[model samples]
Target: MNENQSSRRRFVVSVGTAALVGLAGCGAQQGESAQTSTQQTTTQTETTTPTEAADTPTTTQKSSKSDADGPVVEMKTDNEGSYFDPKGLVVEPGTTVRFVNISGTHSTAAYHPDNDDGPLRIPDGADPWKSKLFTDTDAVFEHTFETEGVYDFYCAPHEMLGMVGRIVVGEPQGGPATESPTDIPPAAQESLPAVETIVSEQRVSGP
Candidate 1:
């Protein structure tokens, strides 16, 4: 072969090798950039996950007796025995009464014909309320008094034991509860608070 042709062939080979190396370097740089972009995307997704969890709603808590719409009554036990803590209460019409069981099994039942065929002790047109036996501590029941009259309630299982109470709504008015009770047990008759006393005192505690 001739000298010029050999030299020209060498130069061509050298230029081709340099071009391939440059292309390889560019490919490596592009691959690294793509990998970095993917890593940044994964990091962004991880950072937003905790914020989503923080935005989730939480459970609501139960309201306390002080937050009730009206007065609160507690069915509790003491050295004397099981009974309503405040034997009598006086409230305004449309007031709600919250009955909370502090201890032992008890219930807040109105003296009504629907409950054990008892005579109506609440106002004639007033709605009767009866609660199931509350055995769980802190169990609660609520009733709203729309009528302006006396209300006499008893604990069914403990009525004979004198677990009875009274409530006078607004001014004292005529009702079966205001009259002398004839159908109740002797203990309940003695334990029930007087409407006059409830009105004057606003609250009467048990004996």
Candidate 2:
């Protein structure tokens, strides 16, 4: 072939090769994008599955407390944080309060000036009592509320760590109002909000 024809043939071949390579590169990029989308969809599905499963049981338990197992007064004593579960509770007079030892070496000690470690906040004529540390079934403490007033108590060792609680028997009657955070030990600062919530929102009229 002549030089002119030869040059034209080479140019056409080069152009054809470049077009083929560009098409291949585009196919590869599209494949990668499709793969990435599938992986992201799978990750989202996995994440949502556990959350949906977890929420159902939690919602059901909170919404439905069976009458058979429910009680007039109950409280939890946790070992891990060395604090009571509810922080405060309100119950009727003559009701029995069952303290479940949920965690720790805990005790229920009435707040009294005679204890010399804390203030006196029990109801008028209410007897003061203290339970021994968790050493068996003694881990469980039960107190009957016979007076209509506020009773404050603490865990022996964890009181300094803010491990304290209160019980309001029947409706509040001439009891000290909601206590300020400044009145409690410095360690109990975190518990002040819970104290306020129970005192204001949980009080029940004695039946």
Candidate 3:
């Protein structure tokens, strides 16, 4: 073959090889870019799914200051009769107690002279409280105890039925509530918790 022809053939073969290599490099770069994009999308989905689920909220009832500080006493009625649950309770000074009526008609009245001219049972000079009759279910009455002594109260209408309760603010005190009363009925007097029991147990259930 002539020298010029051989040189031209070699040059054409070299040019074709270079073009093939360039095309292969461009195809590899495109594939790598596509893989990286897919990985990024998968990572974002995995990270965000759990975060959204963790932000969900739950429902609950609101609590009042009175409920948070003192215990709840329930007035309930059964086949036997109507009575106050936890007939006796002990609390710190300034604690507000919540009285809830579960069933039957009821009222909480302090054994003070101001209330129906009853005997003085609570601490002297302490504020008196008397609740109206509760005929419906889920009725609520609240009272704050500021005096540090024994408080004797009863269900006015049902007092004859022996529905009575006692509350000790901080300690026991010498009062009409502490002594055995001859004025009230036997059942009503008996329903009143003993001062010793209320101080020791902190809570006493109805008879």
Sort every candidate by TM-score, greatest first: 1, 3, 2
TM-score of each: 0.68, 0.53, 0.66
Higher-lDDT candidate among 1 and 3? 1
User: lDDT tens string, model 2, 1-207?
Assistant: 112211011111122222222234435354432222222111000000112221121101111222343332223333445666556777777655655555456666667544444565675545554555543222345555666777777777777887777777776565542444455578765553343455677742211
Task: Report clash pairs, candidate 2.
Answer: 79-103, 79-104
Q: Summarize candidate 3's per-residue lDDT along 1-207 as a digit string, tens digits.
A: 112211011111122222222234435354432222222111000000111232221211223424564588888778868788889999988676777778888888878776687887887656556777777566566666766788888898889989989998887767666777666767888888888999999999985
Go through the candidates in order and give each one's C-alpha lDDT. 0.70, 0.49, 0.67
| Candidate 3 runs further than 4 Å off | 1-69
TM-score, cand. 2? 0.53
* Residue 139 in model 2: lDDT: 33
List ranges where model 1 is wrong by over 4 Å: 1-62, 67-69
lDDT tens digits by residue: candidate 1, 134-179 = 7757766667676788999999878999999999989778878888
Worst 10 residues of 2 by lDDT: 40-49
Q: How many backbone clashes does candidate 2 have?
A: 2
lDDT (Cα) of model 2: 0.49
